[model samples]
Target: MSLYGGMNTAQGSNSCLCDLRSDTMTAPDGAMRAAMAAAVVGDDVYGEDPTVTVLESRLATLLDKEAAVFMPTGTQSNLASLMAHCGRGDEIIVGDPYHIYCDEAAGASVLGGISMNAIATQANGAVSPADVTAAIKVDDPHYARSRLLCLENTVGGQVIPLDDMRAAARVAWDAGLFVHLDGARFFNAITALGCEAIELANYADSISICMSKGLGAPVGSVLVGSSALIMQARRNRKILGGSMRQAGVLAAAALHALDHNLPDLERDHANACALATALTEMGAGDIQLGSNMLFFTPRDKNPDALRIHMADAGIRIGGQSPAIRMVLHRDVTDDGLDATITAFQSYFTKE
Candidate 1:
């Protein structure tokens, strides 16, 4: 793709710097490409794609879900999940700054007519159960029906505590609302918690797991839930025009990621910790470290200068946000970390 489209042309950017932008920046290596080439393809719209079928089933078993469906992107997977769980004019309660709210361009509202009620998240990224209880609308036509509770894991790089999730899910479930987990960084959270995937997945009725991020797949996300819910999601996928014809090519890379890249997640987390320590020692401003992500503001408070400095040093960090984020993934090598640290050293005048 890059050869034809020039999407990933070195242009000095890929050759020189480490990209601390996002985990989604990973590119498929030769082995993953080989797997994609070797995949047995079929029309998935008719449910005949064996590779897609295997990938979905593999994820379902991993999270102990009854079924799973592959989607082109996490946003589509999440949007379809919302549509599957809620009817028109229904409400979804989620944490503020969560992907479903701040990102994804409000597809649930724009496309599905589903409304969102966002609760301010505490420092650790867990919504207060008391706040969730208050956010539930009373049974009245005056308010959109509160139908689902959406939560995210790896909130700010730390796993949301299991007890907090249980408390909040209980509140939503007791109120007759379904639960959905946006686990775009699902494996990162599980790896950080050192718990079985089912332990975290058990909190939600449906789960969206993205393989493109951190897991090192070039593309693909899987939504897992009960058979009936997945059936509904499949219908919604068709409605959303996400139904694919020969997606096994993408699924094959995802399967390879699950097999080869997942075990490397903890290494990414370790790299994050190491980077955080180096930056903190250098007095990098306001550092927030989590599993495989670090958010920091340079002490000079000039992200523009810092970004340029790192770019010159051959390290690509994130945007000009007040607290810039740097993500560590399987594609980020030790040399990349070293270059990033050296760039920061020059920025901080420590060297």
Candidate 2:
């Protein structure tokens, strides 16, 4: 019963599984709901939504950007950013495993007529400056003009070292390319790196911050960058149908999360470390800890069987091939972590 004993949602029954799928599963708490209900509303399309303005401005200042725009999701936010940064027929240099290239449905190319020239990523998720330099296309008519370089922080839950990120950005800037960062887990990276928000932000021309991820906001992602770029993204947002009215309800939740959940992101990281330590000690296969996320392969090398066993034990995990990631977030408390370890114990130690 302790597996999901601390969950705060009514959507799940009295007896529920401890969900370790992703931080996206976190629900807005009572205080966040109250803030949403009490939020002031306006027409955001017309730029009159006060709460949304506050959220955008707060992030802009926090990241030392000239402006920020809120989007319904990080995917759209990144797409808008790519569109804003790259022109039609222009190319972007990004890591092959980055969310922009791998997960966002290649919207930059599909919708924006932009091309992604992917460079291989290291185990720690940092792209080499040499690869970036080599990936940039020549100024000839045959090649797509490389106009932007995209990077992600806390890729697979591991923080990209600050110096490495800066070096990559320097290569892009020297080549006259704009730098865009998929900062979906922005706060988690900062907590793990122990640096100020601007320190990680200074190198990128634009950063997409997703509040709904580990920050525990019900929904909202912010794109912070230069005012001119943001102005263009607003139009892109409208074209992409990301423009919202009376969206202060969602913005209010993000504002609340910034105050309460953002500071406590470290708790999730600690829990992840604990899980990794326990699983490693128990001879769990290749447990990799990344910030607040951990990746594990079943000892039996049967992910399907592991999924079944964990589910039977009141713990829910993803069924990703090779290895599955178990995320730690605000909703997953110490008790949930203990339950997860206990479930692993039963399976790995059995027979």
- Candidate 2's C-alpha runs over 4 A off are 1-15
For all predictions, the C-alpha RMSD in Å is: 3.3, 3.7
How well does model 2 score by local distance difference test?
Answer: 0.89
| TM-score of each model, paired residue for residue | 0.95, 0.95
Clashes of each: 1, 0
TM-score for candidate 2? 0.95
* Per-residue lDDT over 69-110 for candidate 1, one digit per residue giving the tens place of the 0 to 100 score: 999999999999999999999999999979999888999999
Write the residue-wise lDDT of candidate 2 on 1-351 in tens digits: 222222433435225457787888888888999999999989998889999999999999999999999999999999999999888999999999899999988899999999889999987999999999999888999989999999999898989999999999999999899999999999999999999999999989999999999888989999999999999999999889759999999999999998888778988898889989999999879888899888888777887778777877878776576688788888886677788899999888883
Off by over 4 Å in 1: 1-13
Kindly provide the TM-score of model 1 when superposed on the true structure, using C-alpha atoms.
0.95
Model 2 clash number: 0
